[model samples]
Target chain A: MNERPIHVVGGGIAGLVAAITAAEGGAPVVLHEGGARLGGRAVGSAERPWVNLGPHVVFTDGALVRWLRQRRIDVPLCGPMVRGVRMLDDRGARFPFRQGLQLLPTILRREAPVDETFRAWAENTFGDASADLLCRLGGLITYHHDPGALSARFMWDRYRRTALSPDRVRWVAGGWVSLVDALAERARTLGVRIELDDRLTPESLPDAPTVVATKLSGAGRLLERDLSWPGARTALLDVATTADPGWPAVIADVRSDLATCCMIERETAADPAALGEEGGHLIQAQLGVAPGVGVAEGVSRIEDGLDVGFPGWREAVGWRRAQIVVDGTGAVDPPGTTWRDRPSVEQGDDVFLAGDAVAAPGFLSEVSVNSAVQAGRLALDARRRRAFAPGWPTAELTPERRLAVLAAVLPSAELTTTTVPGADEVAPVDETGPGYRIERRAGVTRATAATAGKGGVRVTRVVASALPGVARAAVERLPVWRRPFRR
Target chain B: MENQVRAAQGGDPFAMDALLTELAPWVGRLCSSIALDKGDDAMQETLISVLKNLPTLREPAAFRGWVRRIAVREALRAATGDRAIAVAEMPEVAVAPDFETAVDIRDTLTKLPPSRRAVLVLRYLEDLSEHEVAELLGTPEGTVKSGLHRARESFREHWREA
Candidate 1:
């Protein structure tokens, strides 16, 4: 068995999934978290009992639940939310049954096109009112201010997922805190070494198969690559009330075509012990706000909806909190791009990306799970290559061998500005092994020195400095001129 | 998958890139197995051909078959164009002391002519029927059958000599 560790950065769902998957595949795993805690967005704060940054629901049919169930990771879950679903329309009345029936026919309609906008396609397929309602209701899943402008394929897939089988939606009983705890425990059981509060930069990264599961922007900074994708911005409101008023379980306010719908879920109604032994209703409402819309303005709109839905809710409120989360939800594909068009997972440089925004396909947090699994599998393959080859000195890599090299090099992007760490930056190699130094300049890989001769080859000097084009072309396109120095 | 094909055909560079990524490993494997040392050249040529003719492909479902034919043809061309046919021709055949050691399949493969290697790879490695191999190679089934028979006999003869 290869004991070489696959390092994972970030402690989010993606990071945890990657670590566990790689570790279970028989690779020694070391997970690093910048923060002191394990869960990133999944668990808000250790002090807060079960409250999260927002109300998160994991569907039984989705990838997240399937992955968890397969691994036997026990997490208490709430119902499929069948009863008390009050959908308020723009007329300030309940979701008209006739209009709702129109959407059901769309369930049997032809698949959506990838290039067209969802709004255009939905309006053409269904009527204007149905389209508007579909896009607004999309806020419940996307948390995007304008879901209609997104790709038809993106919106349609999620729409079918939710609308077709509404019963698939399940909530984590005690919040994602429990799920996070379960994942951490599973990772530990698989012998994953967890490092807390250890933030790693690209240059400082160990020369090992690694997964960077941080948020897209953070990954870009770490890898010195402009890794970006579309994410959702929404206002989150957490309200705790003293009275357990008989309010609908979830109220979706699609009261205006101009504004996205506001969704409020009463947690206490689902789980009586949601707050504590002495149960108090914890209602979490989220409203997608357009650009320049302040959290206060979004909160105000949501409160207005709450006034219509939950009567006397303002008077019953014990405490309430409102804030805006920018680009917090998974990812939103624009008019033309699919999930494949997002930032790719296989970031050449022994560093794979595993997150919601990366290339792997699924709904919401499911994307993170899918991407992490893929990144883990890729990291395992890389680990296998290194373990088998044992520092091969061949400069002319076969197309097959180049894949090994693909998972090996952390290209020289900004390492000159980055003060170098210890010699074991990539991975701890034997001092006498054939370890060739990496040097890059202008989208080409160069090996400056090889510290090997009689005993064996050791990479002597690694100079990691190159132009910004490294992200776009350096790794994927080496221009056939990149041949590392022969030992 | 069809969506990717359609997008690539419609001149989406990103879609083409994705398609290349999806097909690279399989193409590399086929090219390396048949073309040997010139596998790199064969892979590059095959991908170039695949991407260039992507627009001409009418049915996206037949993509794998189409790519397989191209890969086989490119690999055979690369192998036959090589100047190193006499690499081991002049050497005296030597038997190894470890009698139970199986012949290194890749090494054994390198000894055959390019066409013969293609026949063997298509027949055994790809698990294609003799008729399928002949059709893929644009040759008669009789020629495929005879080529396969002769190839097996030659392998046995080599083993006996060793």
Candidate 2:
């Protein structure tokens, strides 16, 4: 019965998710947030309450929504309204129906190789026009100036999910403020001690399992590890107006080949409360800018698109804010690299990472959810693995041997296993432990118990028996010639 | 909503996925309240049954009630079929520092039998009356009343902190 609390740093989505996941299993958790409030980039500052930093939407198909559903956290969502979708090419705010039909085959093509660049793959798979259009459209989803230079697999996977027909997008009614509050409430309910404005240095961190869920730059400084990754720099423009010019729900501006596209979403179209003012509409626009592109230039370019999409938008503006965001939108994989090549979750000595940039899959914030859940599970396992029923006749054995022993003893138990992509499935035996559910599939990468996860069924729960150990020991006592499992 | 359901029934994978997302939280909450640790398995079983028999549902308006009935039935079957690892038999893990604050109502409800827990969950959690609970569980109103009384008494006994 170890009561030591797992510490989670930062109160952002990753930190909150990690804390909740850890605490749900009865483990004590303490969350440290440097800011006065939660919801890192997911929400806005006090000046603009409930307004997302830029534009944010949750796809019903992503990991974030899945986690919300699994945890039963009710987030009010508005279904997709694909009615007013304007495409901005060189001409103006038009559908570009003919051009869209041409790119349909490329978008529908499912798989793309990781080694190839998105530009190269699209050109080879479809045509030069296809590559040019996709790379431009890519700016809307990935706020990257040069998505054409990124990995094909990375961009393609995101494009399929992001640009799917009818758009599975669900706008959070109160922005992510509602989600953050719900997560914070859930964390507190699970007895997760929350400390606001409590930033910790490397020296000040507790000597317990901790989830460092801050941005990579902060995490690199705190963990003192080189956690650098390629991220995006984009310009954000949010304007509030009472003018109802009947603006499109979203505008993808890919007019100039010199400057990449920008995505403009009218939040009021989906949820009227977005503006926080009566008869007001919130028009938010964001576009990827090249390295030297300043805020002035980015905002002007966004205005050009706005002019085409919403006529008389300039005079109708009541309040507007524009800024340049650097590394705000997670990592972007280069031509040859993949998400697997990003910073890993398992930092040695029981310190795990949980954030958008860490090595996990999904689109945008979905990456955070995936990594947070993984980090939380690993941290929980790390903290509790040593505390099996105090009297189970314990013996510390290798993870593989432990699984082997469990297989040897529990010969009649129902075997439940998920096959590792590149590794052999651990042969398991089953029957008597009616409640024994096995998910052990992870350790093939390394033999370490922490990474042995998702699979390495805790044989410590079953293998701590004399009968199991005897079976394994008797078999091991034999020489290599006498080994039965040797293939 | 009917069109979405029809699309799902017509085997559109994306539509089906969206429907699952829409209904998952409700189903998850119900299954968890009844099945406790077995809630996940119960939810999966319930979802499969719901999706498989969706075509058989004549009234799309009755979807919510019908789904609730299926969820309760699946949860009960899952819980009743398996003799749970009794709360007392659980390994004596050290309680979190704020254990009192974190103690879920489910922990105390585990002290009662599954049937009593069901009645309590249906009556209170579902906000249904004793008569409604009787109809839901297919029991007499008197039986429902007495079962609910015992469940509440057991809760009061177990949840001294509350």
Candidate 3:
């Protein structure tokens, strides 16, 4: 309606979802991705059977599931191999982490004196002996090296979510790349124009509602503002194995420095016999590292962890690849950076924000999808309101009318009313007695109630343009406070 | 704030709007921490319930606490139903204090029942007293105390195992 296409920057899952939503809402859309391929961190290779950027999966009840269902898109997914994890120690001792409903006990039974470190809480609750074990386990699971520096409350929340309803994990039949391709195809069918390998700048951004869905650093560059947040760096390895460990797909060495190993024999599509020596099974190892650690050292540590956990791992492997990821899954949520501190969907009048870094209600990719959906919906709604009535006054209805309308719509809501100026309007209103301030600007009659309180309700009626005759008749019949229209 | 709450209770739309704006973020945070992925839904349901029953609230000053109670309950419901499921699964495994132990607080929390999680969150994160938690959860003080003790003992037993 505004003759400008809504611009969606970044081709990650968030940007793709935003572009698709806007396009489906009947708005012209353009999606820009700086990378050669979409999916950002979720990229996977056809040549590599099981290797992905990072091990990615969706929960059974995750946002992706709901989105896919809503879109009527079908993608085959294999259910989790095992509900519980396999814990490998330094001495290659394997421990069973079963999915039985009753394994975890509530750790925070007593009131903590203050917000402290995970170690402090663990020490107080489980005693010093098990406290260290808990801290290491926390670091391993969260992909952070030092759990002691993390907030106890934050850790507890994540743990509680995982424990309460441990949804079954599933992966796309093919790698994550296939899912990305499917999404792109769906987006294209919905009339979204996607431009790949085109880096965007603030000056080059189109004059339309823009949704920035890039990583935090990339988003900062496009928005021309510093949006730095604390994060973790890690080295990831993809390896092929000849023999299956006959265990759960994921085996985490909690004794190591937050090391995790995952097998993909069940997820990959490659044939075992076709491949000469190495079996069809694939394993992935991830190790969290310090900020300044060199790639060589990080890779070395990851290899060592794999060797310690699986003694004959090298003999059983065929091929391997390693790479380092910086701020892999957006910014790591540290202490003090709770949900309240995260960025919201609407950044400005015309700008919407998305990505895992945004203040959304889910974890990881779920956050990305949810935030993108919200951003897309808000952008569409804002555009609709703008295109509702053109070349007409934006009428600020009186509180009485607003109350009447609300009462009609929400019959259960108790009704009350007091006149107030519309806070969303461009023109300021005078603070006088029970009267209306009508200011006409550029063929627009902006109305404001003088007696409105600061916390008063404000309503805008587009009927002045949509149904001018009816609006005029209603205004004349209503008992407006005795006041002359101000010039 | 008190005046605003009073005005909202009296059916003042403006004050209600203001109160809603002020409370949304706090409620969102609480819900997210408790319900995780379902936080948004829980937050919306909490606000709706709160507004629907606002006229019945007697003390305007206790508005925040009242909202918190609703938020926690909504979040818990969104997370999982029937806290008894977790209580039934408590195994008598002893977890020894060893640096080599693989179990972390997360794994433990994941295995914990929902009711225990609620008690733990209210106690440590919300920093509520036992009596306050009991009252908020509509459970007796003695029950809250015993439940907490049993949960801790179960955790110690699990950790004490090799």
Candidate 4:
């Protein structure tokens, strides 16, 4: 019985993660997925060339990065990035928020710069035009909730990990399907048994241990009981076009509020190389439609009649679009469902529960995958402990609170720089290079200051120094490179 | 599933075409699990993904499971992150001339664990054998047999009297 394979039900992120983790940890695994294929919700269908789910971008701090890198899954990293964002108002007005050089100037007002509180910062930084754009246009796109409700911590952490880092934000070369295939291949090599259309009942799982990692409703039916989960509301849209969206990436306040939409163009004669070329496809607009944003009661309008399937450019050509809606506070687990909503890890002897919906209330492929992996680890741990005393570590993601932090701080960009003595300073002698006078400075470099651009007025303290060795003779030969110090 | 898997690997355009032709029925079945209104779009996505990635399939026998995964992924993705309208409120929109509901067994079936529920439908309802289920699932025959036994018991226990 100990040699029997560990049973994993569901092939979604969690199920796959669990299987992979278990296999990597040197345990034999048999993954049972009721579906015909694997890759749960992250990859696209056989008929669909594009991913069904909206984009699931990776963050540096995200467990996904570690999992992918550790597994040696090849993926394109870095960006199609954004530093500051612009808000579009309901009336179709546009205004940039405290962006670029303007941020430092606006920090002292009522919503002062130094305050950094979402509301105070916005009020201080944005003028009437910008404020209206943020409240209206941005509200429509992100959903209408006071930014104040968002957590500054989670938002900033994600932003810092992804946007600012040189190593964050990677898209699989073949979209998400590539990543899924690689994981599946690795699982196979590890001797993990992947069975499609093979569903699990409490009886079918190995006597060793079993973990269920399906959706909340699916898990309920398997157990013939409902588990508590918070009502979650979200929407996913996939739009395919003849060309890319105008912007590589845009997170602004638009009238049409969308949680996440990945608009892809079918491979055409235009240019296949350009697909993920500019770091990502395009920004189109600056409306980052995150799921948990603006989720308060009374902020959203209950209007319907949204039309899909029409190509914005050519009315004659039909566009392929898929939209999904989920209420974060719904009746499955229903609203007011907290930790009690989750199932006990130890379900009679060796059975345990795992899944994104089970771990916490939110929509994240990475989280779902990590939860399942953790669940598998727990299952193994339980087996080792010879106890079903809920051995696995609860995800402890702190969902809404974490999302609030993401919403509030995820958009800000922070940059740090350190200077070295040689490249950091050179005398700004008037050297005629075409029509431009390059500003060079000479000094003993102390600290590197973060600058928005490579070109600007740089300040350096004058230091007594002598040109060493042949460097002086070389400087004397190149008359165009130096100027006498003005006394 | 085998043909498409092969064509996808051999890079045969016609085999790829045949694969898409075969995908409709399976994708349609997977789409049924989701709310009906979103089925078509979700189905379209499933088919498109299956078509593009079929060639990348390393294991031909795993075709059915691969397609199933893609379809379910699309359906699940579409289910969340979209606005939900009462099913009765939205008119069913079909891209093809024929789209049918064999039975309206919504209450009992839709509620089951997606994996278990899929196995129950394919193995019992669809009359596929344990080997066939294994073939469809890309698992070994032993795992399929055990999974079926468990899924059947689970379904019977949950749906029999209720």
TM-score of chain A, all candidates:
0.78, 0.80, 0.71, 0.56
Name the DockQ score for candidate 2.
0.02
Binned by DockQ into CAPRI classes (incorrect, acceptable, medium, high), candidate 1 is incorrect
Residue A449, model 1, lDDT: 30
DockQ of 3: 0.01
Rank order by lDDT, top first? Answer: 1, 2, 3, 4
How far in Å is the alpha carbon of B4 misplaced in model 1? 37
How do the residues B18-102 of candidate 1 rate in per-residue lDDT, one tens digit apiece? 4554566557667877888888778777777777788899999998889999988888779878443322232322432222333
lDDT of model number 3: 0.59
Which CAPRI tier for candidate 2?
A: incorrect
For residue B39, give model 4's deviation from the true position in Å.
57
Pairs that collide, model 2: A412-A430, A412-A431, A413-A430, A413-A431, A439-A455, A440-A455, A440-A456, A441-A454, A441-A455
DockQ of 1: 0.02
**Candidate 4 residue spans exceeding 4 A from truth:** A82-87, A90-167, A201-208, A244-251, A255-318, A327-348, A360-363, A386-487, B1-162
CAPRI-wise, candidate 4 is incorrect
Candidate 3 segments exceeding 4 Å error: A45-50, A83-85, A90-92, A97-103, A107-115, A139-141, A242-248, A256-279, A385-487, B1-162
The per-residue C-alpha lDDT of model 3 at residue A427 equals 18
Question: Looking at the true structure's interface, with contacts defined as alpha carbon pairs within 8 Å between chains A and B, what fraction does model 1 recover?
Answer: 0.00
